[model samples]
Target: MSEDAPTRADGDRDLFDPNYRAAVVDLLGALAYSELRAFAQLAKDSELAPTLGHTSALAILAAHELRNFKLLTDRLRALEVDSEEAMQPFVEAVDAFHARTTSSNWLEGLVKAYVGEGIAQDFYREIANYVDPDTKSLVLAVLEDQGQADFAVAAVRQAIEEDGRVAGRLALWGRRLVGEAITQAQRVGVERDALGSLLVGAPGSGGADLAELGRMFVRLTDAHTKRMERLGLSA
Candidate 1:
């Protein structure tokens, strides 16, 4: 296959299965809405920037998120799914996550942009492992860092350096963010059975078993700890 084309999984016919297709649709839908919301959140958070440089950087990240949203929607259209319809089911859950985790200050917003989004991307990437190669590629592509990680880490670490107490507060904030994130994931699993089947190895679903599901969470937790440390905060 050419580099521009989505490579099909060799002899993996699960893509044609109804259950598998539904799972992919749910995955893409959740991701598409997430990118859309990330774009909105980033733009809104830009107003909290203390400097013009920070504002411009956040605007750039927001633009990247919009582009990623387009990519996901385009893929949904390719699957003959209405992008809006696919995203609708996830709107309430995703919006609730943002609402509950609203940041009170510039630093908290930055940490949410970093730690909160980081765990989400990690979770999606883990789910990608059980999906078709084409869908997996798109998931990973849309989840790309877009310079947010380095930017947030540098800005947050600098703040912590200026005030050692900043680390303590942000550490607490990071912990809460992770907790909320896990809760959101659990909620999605409960509400989206098609999507959940992808994690539990449903018949013909091409997913992991319970043991592997447990390992996936371990991996996600480990990655989140590393991200918190990068922000100079305790996990």
Candidate 2:
């Protein structure tokens, strides 16, 4: 904690070891896959929008996602990691999660994106702190919400203002998404221990209590529920 002493990231003197590279590569690949899938989901979800403006915005946002996907994938290739293969392992989990909680309406889609991406950003922000300086910055930089949560929140708010009746269904939809998302996240944990160890931070790293990963997940869900409430959706 002192400026005089060099900060210790892990027990190893070199933090950029093979395990770290694997973790970094997988992490980047995961994000690239996320962007690609979000592009498709956004396009589909945008169809539920009654307004042309909202729908067009979704298309624009989807473009942003593809652009990001390109950047991340390029970085993965530069690192000599097979971007597709790195992303393959967790694809089923993510795909199943999205499918199980597919949104039925515009507000539902926005709520899911806003709520889901918010929680994911929290996890990524924590991960940004766990890695070495370059990777920490990279992680922080990739934690994107500009084209997703921010846009979705405004659209949802405008929709609610225009049609107050949507509150009931969107609220229920939000809750269901929160539930399904955590379910998928738990499944991801079982399947991807690296994430739990990294995003959750290592057990002894002077970071957060890795043992409290479950509690942290619960806390994120709780906060997301509060966001729903703030958006006029009951928990």
Q: Which candidate is the best by lDDT?
A: 1
Which stretches of candidate 2 lie above 4 Å from their native place?
Answer: 1-16, 199-211
TM-score of candidate 1 relative to the true fold: 0.93
lDDT of 2 by residue, 70-149 (tens): 87777666666678988887698778878887777677778877786566556555555666675566566666555676
Minimal lDDT window, size 10, model 1:
1-10
Candidate 1, residue 54: how far the Cα is off, in Å: 0.3
Q: Given candidate 2, what's the lDDT at residue 13?
A: 23
Off by over 4 Å in 1: 1-13
| Clash totals in order | 0, 0
User: Tens-digit lDDT track for model 1 on 91-132?
Assistant: 898898899999999999999989888888888988888887
RMSD of each: 2.8, 5.6
Q: Ten residues in a row with the worst lDDT in model 2?
A: 1-10
